[model samples]
Target: MARIAFILLCHKDPKAIIRQAEQLTAVGDYISIHFDARAPKDAYAMIRDALADNSNVTFARKRIRCGWGEWSLVQATLHAVEAAVEAFPRATHFYMVSGDCMAIKSAQYAHAVLDADDVDYIESFDFFESDWIKTGMKEERLIYRHWFNERNQKTLFYRSWWLQRRLGLERSVPADLQVMIGSQWWCLRRRTIEWILDFTRKRRDVMRFFRTTWIPDETFFQTLVRHLVPEPEIRTRTLTFLMFTDYGMPVTFYNDHYDLLLSQDYLFARKISPEAGQLKERLGRLYASDRTDFKISDEGRKLFQFLTGRGRIGRRFAPRFWETETSLGRERELMIIACKKWHVAKRLVGSIKHHTNLTAIDYLFNEEDTPLPDLGGIQTTLEKRTRHRRALMRMLFDYHETDRLIFCIDTANLDLMQDFFSDRSTTRLLEIACEFTDEYLAGHAKRVGLAGEETSDETLKQLLPTIRYDVVFEADRIRDAGFPNHGKIRERNTPEENAARIAEFLSVPEDTARSIAQTPYLFAD
Candidate 1:
């Protein structure tokens, strides 16, 4: 039921613009274009002639020489809005978009959502009240006059600001208006658009003030709408899916991003590549489809956010094993228990399995008696096993679906200990202390393929704390030997006391810890 009047601000790619106009016209919407005056006249003529047969499309008569961060862009937008208002008489809303934008959702989907309310879809926030400006030109943008193009005339632009600062030539905004800033793309009610147009006609002084303001297109309508409509009637978000680069340019979509585009809940996406024919074709079909419900998968949303650099990049364990990239990002936890004696480490893991909900496994990194028998390919040789120890642990981390896992390794895997400690969200470590004789140390070094490596108690003592760990359980004898604690060392004591310490370290209940300590396997020796 909602009739939308789309005003496209175009500068380049006439063929692509023609195709987009056709798509919008086919969707039962009105189209108006305000081609840049500085762009090639031939390009504008081509677009006009191509869409001449369509009664739904119209071009603005007045075109302004638009420039990035200059007043001309806002002037062109005003001209387009005027043209759209006169052309589409029954338009419920006036939606402004760039020529490079493509429809991500069907027109009916947008109409269904907008027809539910008379609310204005625009992002408007007070400039001084919010950290809206990311380029560090927050207040100065409105306080100074900018005549030079920021994108093409960088030298003159910066020099103008510098000279103005030196001379202390600062301008004041109108006292009646509180300056607002937001995204340029907006879908505003037709009544709201008319009110803005009327205000611009009467308020010549306010128009002049914004004439020299930097990027006034982003601020002019944003500031006016706040004054015309009540705050409750406006939704402070854009319907267009836009992602900007660190340098402040829109990220252009290509052919490979078709699936990504489908996953978006937005109606449209901005700044697509002009030559992306396959992407355009697929999205055009999406617009023509009768699918009503638009829902996005959580996995897809997270991946898209990560792709745009707005979300964290998750760690992948064995990427080759799966068709898509999978990351164990805080989904499951990995706790590695390491000690010199395998028997003692096994006993501790047994106790944990006896009490907690953790999936505990003994000697995961062992050569012959590994808990994971399927790891034969990864642990074929001692050298390869030593080299791929980190990968092995991460594979285990990814393989298990449990909320928490406790696995046992030996001090021989100390070189790769730091890798497990890097992502503290999913990994923790527990080290139990034991005496290593000269023969035992030599055998350990030879077994782990580090025969000639510095393998002594002093070397081991110096290396343990340097590699970060969650907890270290040791008797007072090791403490007297000047082993640097790094606040992770725990004094070995009675089984019940040890359980209490482990319980506190793992943040489990004291009762649970006592139950683990009372296990026959833990206190047998």
Candidate 2:
């Protein structure tokens, strides 16, 4: 079981605590909080009431001022860890998040991010150095703290001198690493946390220094893990959906880089003031979500909204979350292409008609008498053949006003090209299609790795870095559809068909099929 150990630093801001708890409850995640001892009892009661339904949350006994350089954060984190260990010491992993952050759907997405295949999601901006070793921190954020405490004579100046002079503790890392500043907000494997706890047992001066300093929270976990562990894997930057800055501090988003921090791809802007309602409204329109009434001031709320629910952004490309109705254009201007299925085809067309954009999706597939599966509510369409695909591509390029056209393909059969072109050739179709259109696609904006693997043909080199998937499955769907689901898709699903299409598409000899198989890019590549 993967248990999330959420720790809320309950400042006097009771409303923030309540809202945070509510958001967590919405996703069935539990939390534990370290409320400031100075807070009113009423506030705890309120927090308790808001979080009551979540069996996973609890209020910790240790109350301390939440600050940087102080030992409180470390202590608080330890306490939360102890509680988590007690609650579920056997958990697969532990994720530590603040109260302000919330979830967006896609548990699968979370799983994938945390999996071992991907490195931890951290952004390191700056770099420091003591030669062979590297840690993240640059000229920026290197001196944002000042401790005037008399007790700090032992900690602040003296400790700084000790580390600087005695330990020779300086290091440099990639500059981009300085930008992301992986926050304490992070997920750690159970073994990693246990390792961290064990590793810190021997570092006495570090703990002593941390006690009287400010922003110790910022450096403690990072420095300790980095120096001791060969590859400490600490994040200097935070990666949560929400971020905070005091009023006087000026925040720069990596220097004017991009026009927007789009939630669609890796980021969404949060913490705007209520005055930025126009932006909120615009975000809603741009993404097509029903989320309205923007809060320019509530960064956490905006973050929560973005992380947990469908905002206009999701609605823009995939609006199924918002409304179920689709539009049918005035002229019933749909060109349906089907092989021979009718039952499934009728049902499919009916389903497509139920909720499409008006003046969108002009073509349809329907000549076949095949039994089309009634796909309840999932959206769908007919497959395109090599010949028809050329025709469609030509039509789109020639008219440039063909409303919207969708090419649908059958599932399962849409695995690889060989399945579709089992007995048919697609070379002519490929050429014609290319002639009619640029390598770029233009029909509609569809919301939409690495390394190694050599190919045989000395001319056929490694692929360049690109996000574009080779459309292997998509192309297979086109090939297997045997023409449209209505008209004649002359391509037979056989070895001969595969040979012909491979020859046609690749402009190779018929005997090249066997050689293509060894190329790795062809199948299982």
lDDT of each: 0.71, 0.39
Estimate candidate 2's alpha-carbon lDDT, on a 0 to 1 scale.
Answer: 0.39
How well does candidate 1 match the true structure in TM-score terms?
Answer: 0.63
lDDT of 1 by residue, 213-298 (tens): 98898899899999999998999988888877657677788886765565565788886887788988988777766667655421
Q: Best-fitting candidate, measured by lDDT? A: 1
Clashes of each: 0, 87
Error of 1 at 38 (Å): 2.1
